[model samples]
Target: MKKRITASLASVLALSTLVACSQAPAGGGEVKSGGEKKEAPAEKVKLSVWHNFSGDDLRAKAVRAQIEKFQKDHPDIELDAQAIPPDGYRQRVKTVAAANEMPDVFFAHAGTGIKEYFDGGLLQPITPLVNKHPEWKNNFMEGALEALSFNNEVYAVPINASVTSLFFYNKSLFEKHGVAVPKTWDELMAAIKTFKEKGVTPISLGNKAAWLAQSSILSSLADRVTGTDWFLKAAKQDGAKFTDPEFVQALTYFKGLADAGAFQQGFNSLDNTQMEQYFIQGKAAMMIDGAWALTNMAATGTKEQLDQVEVTVLPSVPGGKGDPNSLSGGAGGGLAISKKLSGKKLEAAYELIYTVSGPEGMKAVAESNSVVNYKVDVDPTKVTSLFLKAYNLTKQVKFTPVYDAYLSSQGAEAINNGLQELLLGGKPEDIAKKLQDAQAKSLGK
Candidate 1:
């Protein structure tokens, strides 16, 4: 899933723009004891919020409506919402933060990189407000709160929840070729072989951005075949090493998938949109992706075409301790309240967050096949059977946060390079060793 790109970019551009214009956000508001203030009688509060939502057109439309509704409901408060493309989001966030002109509130994840905003006192922590609102946690799944917490404070409200990083396949193709959905690694291999023999691209993958392929496919395999918890613990060097058998086996298994021609030709040349096009067009039999892909596919395909598509978990190895039901993912979309806002503006912001995670916003998201973190009663009528099935499937999983696991400075670069090298024929042991060493060095800082 793509985090709100617009929000980050807004922070980036707004930072410099604000400085160039000699402006400060909401006149440099201060935090009180409870970090909230009553409506200041002197001014009508206006705040800017940013998000990078690059999904369904309907999803964007819904966001627009949500903002309008928020403004209408709280006439004294106004919100400025902006969306940005993912390409420049990180750069924008960094540039804006550097300029000391961040937006009042913006969308961001809840890992080490995301935490840097709060750690540097650039973003406001919402723990006090959250604690006062017990209803907030009720909508969230168990353990979902852990990702947003650091040193005992909650920083963000989770927006999207991932079921599992699995594959999306054309059900029609599977039945036409008489290939059953693979349940185990051997069976998955056989299915791929059958599809290849049938002249169909077994899997369509776009790796141009790197993260898409690594997150949806390689990481899925690593977490499924190896132990998710074990691998994460090992990567951090907390209690295990990358050279452990589990890690090696996982890497080797992924390499085998590559050797068997599992992905489309020249995968390295494709991007997420391009690869998704191939799968939705029926040129590819399956695609390793997340729940977000389902929404993307549905947008391109008609009702009948959508009916022909199905999703399944990543297959497990025969007799492997890893379970096919075990998923690798975390809540993708999250919303955070800024520590800077106090009084009526913050109240309005919190109101917006609550409505979005409440029955209404959650329903709209589910209706589009996007999973939300709030345990808000999902109107089965709003969500497709496919989404319902995926949601239920997550209950069977033994999950470990995938992208959030690597906490070191070199962790991302090392993992990305290691994957590219492994695909280019480097040994699994070498990949693991390099990652371990780089990570160790980062941890020493």
Candidate 2:
């Protein structure tokens, strides 16, 4: 993060950070324009890949199937793909990287998230490969590659649009209970009270990973109170701090929801999947999650259940400084090849990445309710009105910064932990102070 984040810098910070460290990624030569090929390597070449797509959700299923297809299509290449749990994926990858055991290819965020790899030479740039495929390069949504590039070199292929926050509500439930969908802070509170009185969870929240609260809720919620410019300044420690009145106010609003019984019992212990299931099964009236949930809902919910789900942003807060129409979002990362790869191994690694990030792979996930940077036509028959609604919603909104996407590792930990603590009755002012201190130290101030 810099002393200031402009619109361009915000676009750059939009991608996330994932895998880092050392070692393998595979074959990349001429992929048949037909999307079909046979590995011609005289000796079998092995490539290890790591990812966090272990779920029954359509998004995960799409990615898993594509990788399997890649392995099947190239019989002479041994593709070792590891499915790490989402919550622990980054740590496991980093732990390996710290031991200098980076995989041949692994998922990574763009921008400052992967800056260490780009600067340390841990990963190779895919700019040449992208340039080689002009059609493929142009297929990407504008500003997508820029998010993952540094010094005129692009690293990861951004796969998802990665809009971090949205409110998914059971429209029928709201109607049945005579409660309107919240459009203002007071209305939101009223809805929460109404749902609580009716014994239905107002919001199904899953914060076990700590990131859920920050990314899916507070990212946009903070924007509602502090605004994008203030957040950018605060993140960079320019003229603001997390301890400032605006940020503390954001935290207070966040805590207000929790204190008012907005979420389910044991929400902090449950995972996001569980939270989604709670809402899907009608135990909860609403859920606050990212656009990624569209696929999950499409895959897991019955048609009737799916129809009842409606999407919206968090309500406008009083005297908020941010744009009410914006959500915290941007292009997300893709497979990154290791620096160790060269010759046939390098080509193989490129092929391994292209298998998932190229046109075909991008389209498959898009069909599964994911928003991809790659332009691919999705089958309308496979998606629900909710899916289409969410997809179109992304196109219409402005994006605000996602803190972890731009935050230093130390600062990220402090805020994430602080969010959990605040809900458990910790003071917002104290967490704000802790965040300010950790971020200052991280910035070497």
Q: Which candidate has the highest lDDT of all?
A: 2
What digit string (tens of lDDT, one per residue) describes model 1 on residues 24-141?
A: 3354555345535444456668878777775446655666566667778876766787777656776787788887778777777655656767776786666766777787666677
* TM-score leader: 1
Predict model 2's lDDT versus the native.
0.84
Residue 151 deviation, candidate 2, in Å?
Answer: 1.9
Q: Model 2: residues >4 Å from true position, as ranges?
A: 1-46, 54-56, 72-80, 110-113, 197-199
Q: Give the per-residue Cα lDDT of candidate 2 at 51.
A: 86
Clash total of candidate 2: 12
- Candidate lDDT (C-alpha), each: 0.71, 0.84
lDDT (Cα, tens digit) per residue for candidate 2, span 1-445: 3556576676665542212111112354334544445465487898899988888777888899989988998898888899988878888877877777789988887555677566667888888888888999999876777768878888888867788788889999999999998999999999999999998889999899898899888899999899888988888899888999999999999999999989888888998888888898888998889887877777688989988888988789999999989778777878888888888778888787788888888888888878876677788887678888888777677777888887788988999999999988899999999999999999998
- Model 1 clash count equals 12
